[model samples]
Target: MNWQRYYKFFNYLNIAEADYFATPEKATQAISTYNRALRMLKNNKDQTEAIKLIQTIADDYPMFPEPSHIYGIHLAEQGEYKEALEYLKRVSLLDITDEMANMLQEQFVVIERELKAERSSARTQTQKTKETPQNKKASLGSVLQKAPKHHNKESLSKSEINAINKKLGNEDPSDLSEEIARENRVSDRRFLISVFVVAVLVISIFYFVIRPAVVNRLDGGQTVNQLQWLENEITDRAKDDPEINKLLNDYLSEFSDESDK
Candidate 1:
């Protein structure tokens, strides 16, 4: 914050005389040095090094509020009110002069008001976001958009509302028609497959066990005693076969019919 803007003595000096003031060691000499360097910097159309050099002096002499105060005023002019307030506040604390103190205090009041207005505006925005339903819907829509494609589209679309419905174990009737019908079709196919497997098992059993016995009996390879022996064996093992009970019942009915004939 180089507060000292114009130097009457250095104004008329050439570039060579200005260089003599630019490099100085002490605080008083540094101020003169800064003013000369600043002019030289402006003449050369380069202010970057000038600002850095001024900043270094301000940092080196924290008690000297001149640099900070000037920098604060410069920042304030550039619309950096908060940063300006910081440097101006430093000047208020350190500089005991009534004019400088009063000036910094005035700037402080203005900057403080601006900061408070900014904070209030931010709080109002936050409160409106909390109260608005549209914002909430927008946020939920964003979440649904990110969801995987395999997930039910209808479920994601109504996710916010469905969350409450899910807790009560309530289902949407509109969804049941398609979903239930599809489930029923799958279940019917599974049932038919199970019946086919059972039929294969039954045929295998009949071919391996019942057919051999029946063939032997028909060929007269087994006498009446041997046929009876086979029948007794089947009867004894009937409980082990799922189809045996029904088969025995049918066989008994046929035998009775033949005897009647």
Candidate 2:
């Protein structure tokens, strides 16, 4: 059977004869819940409950795309880009209208731009951190180069040594070396921390954003089998209802003939 045609036919039937199937009531409830959540967001109220409600509706009613779309938008507005991308990706898997598809594409672009900006910022920070220690080392070298030059002598006189130590805040030369080493260590630690944070963001973007799209593309046959199973279940449930059984048989026969041709 042509799974796309079967899905579209059922979808049209559900919309045209809302009272005949259970989907109309569910859709109504989903819309009501979504509207309530939207009001909470617009009023600037505490959004904890509102977020929870929308998330629940999105999970429970996968056939409806609006809840997921709105949830993704909200997350994106809050700067939760990774989660927003994930929710929006879910919306793509559902039956969406042309307008919804356009909106979804815009959202994907926004999320991608944000992720790229974050990655750029992270790299800049890491570069600055790594440069700091080198700059400090250069400054220290310049200070040492200004030391008084003794003619053909490897060692400085006592007075000259005292002057040099006083210029260095009375710190011993060995202490100065240790202080520079400590500063370098601190800078290294900061650089490592920045690199770790950037790594985590890259991994999250790949897992939540890229991985789902690839998996969905590879699962076409699995999706068709799922639809077929749903059709069988509906047929089994309608065995005692002559009207529903007749309608199912008629559509099935019609589609089977089309598939043959």
Candidate 3:
């Protein structure tokens, strides 16, 4: 079933608006649909229907400010001037481009004029609410603007500003103390890190280079070699003793003669 067309035909707002906002091209199609709905409503005097489509136009594609402004103008056309102003004000606050802002500003001027005309004529001196025709619902904003001057100043009084200051009080010194404590903790960490790195360097030198060299000497790297040389010197010194020389020569000569024969 072609749900979009069917839903649109029967004014099924929820169902018909689904796939219309899936992508940019689809958003364009949706915008066109919204435009058509607006035109049809204006021609047929269906203000309620037009507002619904205008709402959908902004809702479905909020990234584009064009739809938002158009929707606002449509709302204003339907005598929902306050709501229209809110939508346009939101567009301005959203950092929309200058061109769109200017266009909407012009449109607002026209709507504001229309609203002023209606609010001035909506009430009777008999305190009776005079019925407004299609486009004269007394724009709430315009009525408030044109209402008799009220003296309640918008600016805060000096006492009120002082009261606000008293309510705020001074910033707690405890927070500053806590911040200082945090900085001290960070400094402690840095000191510990430096100490740990130096300790590792010292330990590495001892184990890999210093300890190994000491171990080599103690385990007979050069000590045993020097002992052998000393032994040869002692034997040479002993040869000068007559008895020791006779005994060494007799034993060696006997062993040598036995081996030869």
Which candidate number maximizes TM-score? Answer: 2
Output the better candidate (2/3) by TM-score.
Answer: 2
Tell me the lDDT of model 3 at 171: 45
Residue lDDT tens for model 1, 1-261: 232342122232233432332343454566664675557544744555656665675666666555566566657656677887877776677634676666676667777887888889999999998888887898999999996787435655576666667678786676468888999999999999999999999999999999998998877854777868877877877889858867777777999899899
Q: Per-residue CA lDDT of candidate 3, range 38-69, in tens?
A: 56654655756765776777786665454566
Q: Name the best candidate (by lDDT).
A: 2
Q: Show the colliding residue pairs in model 1.
A: 1-67, 1-71
**Candidate ordering by TM-score (highest first):** 2, 1, 3
Please provide, for model 2 over 1-261, each residue's C-alpha lDDT reduced to its tens digit, 9 standing for 90 to 100. Answer: 111121111121224332221367776666667667766655647578987887888778655576677777777877889998988898898766787787778778878998999999999999999999999999999988997777787587776786788887785666468679999999999999999999999999999999998888779878999979978976996788888788888878988999999
Output the better candidate (2/3) by lDDT: 2
Quote the lDDT for 59 in model 2. Answer: 77
Q: What is the lDDT of candidate 2?
A: 0.74
Q: Residue-pair clashes per candidate, as listed?
A: 2, 0, 0
| lDDT agreement with native, every candidate | 0.66, 0.74, 0.65
